[model samples]
Target: MAEEAGARREEAPEETIEDDDGYVEYVPVKKRRLLEQQKLLQRKGQNSSLVEDGRGAAESKPSLLVKASQLKKDQPEISATEQLVRQEKDMIDRLSERKTLMSVRELAKGITYTNPMQTDWRPPSHVRHMSEAECDEIRKQWHILVEGEEIPPPIKNFKDMRFPDPILRKLKEKSITRPTPIQVQGLPVILSGRDMIGIAFTGSGKTLVFVLPLIMLALQEEQSSSLGGGEGPFGLVVCPSRELARQTFDVVQEFTNVLREKNYPELRSMLCIGGIDMRSQLEVVKKGVHIVVATPGRLKDMLAKKKMNLDRCKYLTLDEADRLIDLGFEEDIREVFDHFKAQRQTLLFSATMPKKIQNFAKSALVKPVVVNVGRAGAANLDVIQEVEYVKQEAKIVYLLECLQKTPPPVLIFCENKSDVDDIHEYLLVKGVGAVAIHGGKDQEEREYAIASFKQGKKDVLVATDIASKGLDFPDIQHVINYDMPAEIENYVHRIGRTGRCGKTGIATSFINKNQSETILLDLKHLLKEARQRIPPVLATLDDPMDNVEEVARASGVKGCAYCGGLGHRIGECPKLEHQKSQAIAGTRRDYFGSGGYGGEI
Candidate 1:
């Protein structure tokens, strides 16, 4: 093959164009390179078939070279799709560099400032607030106590606080005249920029205690920053369930809307929860939000997906802190704090404070001002608790009876999803206007059900523990516990649905020996404190020897058997002695066989 290629190269005519200082050349540039390629191909045995014919070899060599050039032209090149992807990646890198900010977690850890308790702080003269003595008297009267540090003096009215003018106006427009005991005490602590743990009953206006602070902080930050903050949330409110998150979001939106109307930048908020299309939430978040209210699960999922960022959040509120720990959000909450390294104001609010909540507070809050209203785990004092011993199978019968007697706008609580559905079905079948909400229902269904109940479209809202905490449904006439909660604290929240905002309401629990034995003692105590009637069956659970008179008083039972009078027992009754004397004289006359003046034959 090599000898044939050499013969073909020698046979081919060589032509060259000489330079100006010309010298003879054997081949032109194009033909010289082509002949060298053919010889190299022949030596490698690639053109061995053409080696058989000298004439065919010269003719096919040009064809083979043309084919090789075509092959090179047809080779794959970088595609538009790939090039566009590369460009997008480069753009993202540039954007990340420009958007870089301080890490919140690192800032939080690096903060070394300590908040010392104020021993001699006084109420400002400009504010129409209570004096230290007045505040202390009010706190003592309401059983409000601080575990660590004393908070600021309570505001006598909403106007006394140094809030933005618009916010203050909104407060009055809403007719929020006087603060509740918890609000009176908690608001001052939060507005003072201290980490706080608020322990109050379910309907003590705990929402506003943290929400007011959140709004104030956002307003101040915007006033300070010319460009405002980033797309991420500046305040993060984490609740245990989607419903509570949405409820909190509604409250935030209501007050923040005032900011927007006053020609301030809109204080945007995003609601993140499961059972909804996440893409919609992501789009809202991408457009930017100032506040984010979310459930722990959905919030954790968003953090993992990088759909939202909380590194810039300066305020963190855990609503229903105890419930969050019970719902298994401890790890998720820790993951959240990992992103919030910046020194932030932490607020923990719960109706009940178990040891778990205390531990969580110690870990999360920085020298928190603990404001506890009333005893922890105690239900609202305003609610009248009624316990009835109804068997599980007879619950429906007793429920119907109670509903017949009670007024409209009743809230029935069940322990689980299946019970919620069953009660809803039973109520509907009985021709009652009713709706159900539970974890099993979709987000839209649950929300619509709650809205309908709140709007009076449905008289009865059958629910599981979902509606037990932090949902403000106004004018709930009765809270019927169709099934006792496994957790005693939940009972407080369940009955708390009614008797909100200092309004009187009834909570009727269908207790049996099976499900309620664990919480019977606490239930009895709660009933006694509320001055409510205790059923005879539940009253028997306590020993008769212990506080018999007190038990009779709580049960509304008069110890007098003769006349059932409240002040005196039968032995101390004046009417009882007269009746006994008359009976004895009649008996003596009959036994003496009418020996006196009466002619008895």
Candidate 2:
């Protein structure tokens, strides 16, 4: 055996190393198991003690607490750079907080001032004052959790909130017989003139929660002092996408039209979005509008050009707040905040806001009350989620069958615009009705597609992630993900297109090996939480536990608190990696959005 080995070594040209004493043969991991590497230390010409293990286990294992000092020294540049970033952020936060505090105080001066028209929002003592048993029952029935002091009771119905006759008539016409769960709790919070962060599944009537109260705010401001031309937009609804903004604009216009029909003073509201005529928007702005629903990009552009101002703007609603803060819009939002002239009654609404972003959002408000229905970032319970493993190539063929799982008005979501086009064309060629929309599509085409789908002129709507943001598609019977989204939050939003307004729906996702294990891990946890049947693929996924508790050191959190990703702790989150920031273990938030970062948002 030795002779054969010697011959093989000679034939293979084994790597030779020269030591202090003489030349020696070096073993490699490819040639031997790592544990056997220690045998090399016994070689004749090797320095046994200095080159212990030779395989470098010490260099590979994560740093031991005892050797952290040495590791810190070894990574001088990385450590120093991280420290510099941390310190700089600390300084910026301090300065920003000071300025923010001043702004908050300036806005708070007349915060207690009440609006005359807003009185209808509060019902009589019998309805306004809820008993403890009733409150508990409401919470239990709706799976609602209310936090913060002096929160108003959730209205049992529209009449309990004392809506104006116009609103009642509109509700009756639309057949919205009662306030939705979110509206039930959310309307009272905003009507109470309190800052709010509301969490509910998409299509849970969240738009009405913020929109209804803002109308009252604008009318109140106008009643006391009529707004002059080019003088006022007392309420602003900021949405993450143009589609979402347009939908919100429609909602605002619908209710505004209802009020107009009742012969109330004209309360003009307009859509401030991109792809529309700038001249037209400016004309509306010049004539003065009471409430302006806008997308951030167009809003920022208008602000930059000084075409409009928020001098009288006090009611600010961030629809799909999480998406607004994320997607590189945080700076733009802070810039918008600078335009606010008073302490605005800010409201944040979304289906899936990460805990960290929620905290970051609250930093801009005063005593914000959080009203969570079911669980934040959770899949809608009304929707049945079906996850299936399909070969990447076969997904197209299987699409036809998935459509059969549900009736008409199915929404199919793809990650790529190209895929959307491909699917839309394939469906059309196969004799199925389909409409597609993506960012690349012209504004007119996108609007047409959405309108046609909403009107039930089309049986299917194929789109990209943009459509998944916050567009409300009524009575969608099914949502099919052509490809699994990389972010689980996006997955939650995509499925939410169905199962809206307390209606049952179905969601089918086609996944394969190409998708990352981490995202699948999140999907797995989400499904488990919702009590959905775990497919065999997801059921067998092994979720690795973090050795060190990150945000949870104090609160016992076992996963990421920032993005709700369970595959990694906050320190290792890929979402935050874009910032090139490293999280120091067990530190006060100063980074992931707030203090007490360990708990759920």
Best by lDDT: 2
Top candidate when judged by TM-score against the true structure: 2
Q: What is the lDDT of residue 322 in candidate 1?
A: 72
As for model 2, its CA RMSD to the true structure in angstroms is: 15.5
Report the Cα RMSD per candidate. Answer: 30.1, 15.5
Q: How does candidate 1 score on lDDT?
A: 0.74
The clash count for each model shown is 7, 1
Residue-by-residue lDDT tens digits, candidate 2, 1-601: 9898678778865445455889677676676664456566555234444347575444445448859878777874744435534543453344235333223334566343232112335566985566878876887787788887767777778877766799888988988998878888888888988888999988888888988888887777777888888877999999988899988888888888888888877898878889998889988888888999988888989988999999988888888888876676776777787787656788888888766666566566777789998767888889999999999999999999999987899999999999999999999999999999999998999999999999999999999989997788878989999899978889999999988877899999999999988888888888887899999998787766433333344434435656666566555566666443423432646456555555533
lDDT of 2: 0.79
Error of 2 at 36 (Å): 49
What is the per-residue lDDT of model 1 for residues 305-334, given as tens digits with 9 covering 90 to 100? 777777667888999987886565766887
Q: Which stretches of candidate 1 lie above 4 Å from their native place?
A: 1-123, 126-134, 226-230, 542-601
Q: Rate the local accuracy (lDDT) of all candidates.
A: 0.74, 0.79
The residue pairs that clash in candidate 2, if any, are 107-343
